[model samples]
Target: MSLFPIFLKLTGRPCVVIGAGRLAESKIESLRAAEAAITVIAPRAIDAIAERADAGELILRARPYVEGDLAGAFLVVAATDDPAVNRAVFAEATASGVLCNAVDDPPFCDFYFPSVVRRGDLQLAISTAGNSPALAQQLRKELNEQLPLDLGDWLADLGNLRREVVTAEPLNESRRLLLHQLAQRHVCAYDQCPSRLLAREHARTNPIPMEKA
Candidate 1:
């Protein structure tokens, strides 16, 4: 299947999880990291989930999920061990037009959770289209080992420099090319960086028209 990858902003958005076992707990934690407003419905929960509930991190309804449990939810995770319960939740979410993931049951899922490698604000996600999660996880491990821990910090500095350059430079092909060149060079946000100094000199010498700059 062809999947369209995306990054979602889940802050303050309502999300539901239909179980509270270990698998479900992982999903809940990921949602929590995104600052989603979470509600978990299960007849029983593991200690960690219960503690989070008591701590007011999320709403816990210690009962079997009933109809309307997914009301107003942006997404639902059917993480129950029982296939019937997971299917039921998926059906309800489908009818309500909410995204659903029936854990480990790829055919019933509207989305699959990917194995991710994170470094500060940088995230690399890998998926095998539900074909092989193990392979995706292997790839994630390889990438984590290869990527530098400080890459995200450097990216942040590059982003800030780009913003400043865009504001000061002219709107032309030369300026556009310079931005790409700057990205290729090992340059920091400092004014003394060789690439930045060269760019500044170039801008001074080849000034664009006032209306275009």
Candidate 2:
């Protein structure tokens, strides 16, 4: 599948999950991490899902899903054990023009959840186009081990450096070279980056000369 991968901002957006089993719990947790306004529908939920409901993390409709459960939902996840129920959800979501993912069923899915390696804001997602989830997970594990832990902080620093250059430097090539040079110090082992300060100083001192157009 030639999927166009994207990271969606689901904060405060409505999301519906059509199951409350262990698999659904995993999907729900990922949604929670993205701060989506989640509504779960199932006749019964597992302990972890029940706990989340009790803690007010999500809204739980403790009953079998009805036809309109996905109404006005931005995204839907059908993680129920029953294939029939999952297919029904996929159909309804498709008809309503909502993005849907039927867990473990690639043909029924509009999207597939990738195995993710996260270090704070730095997240690396690995997907095998739903062809091999196990392979994706293995790749995530390998990347997790190889990638440095302080990468997120490094990225934040680099971002600040980039903004500084963009504000101070008028020449596009000068800004590009500075950004590329900063990218070379990736795979950060330490959180403290003295280069960020130096970069700011460089931006201030070496102002891009104006072109005599």
lDDT of each: 0.90, 0.86
Relative to the true structure, candidate 1 has a C-alpha RMSD (angstroms) of 2.3
Q: Distance (Å) between predicted and true CA of 200, model 1?
A: 4.5
Question: Model 2 off-target regions past 4 Å?
Answer: 186-193, 206-213
Q: Cα deviation in Å at residue 201, candidate 2? A: 3.3
| TM-score per candidate | 0.87, 0.88
TM-score of model 1 relative to the true fold?
A: 0.87
Identify the candidate with maximal lDDT: 1
Q: Give Cα distance to truth, residue 20, candidate 2, Å.
A: 0.7
TM-score of 2: 0.88
Report clashes for each candidate as comma-separated counts.
Answer: 0, 0
lDDT per residue, candidate 2, 64-174, as tens digits? Answer: 877888889999999888999999999999999999999999999999998999976778888889778899989988998998888788777667667766777776766
Task: List model 1 lDDT by residue over 134-197, tens digit each.
Answer: 9999999999999988888877877777776777777788888888987886767677988778
Clashing pairs in 2: none
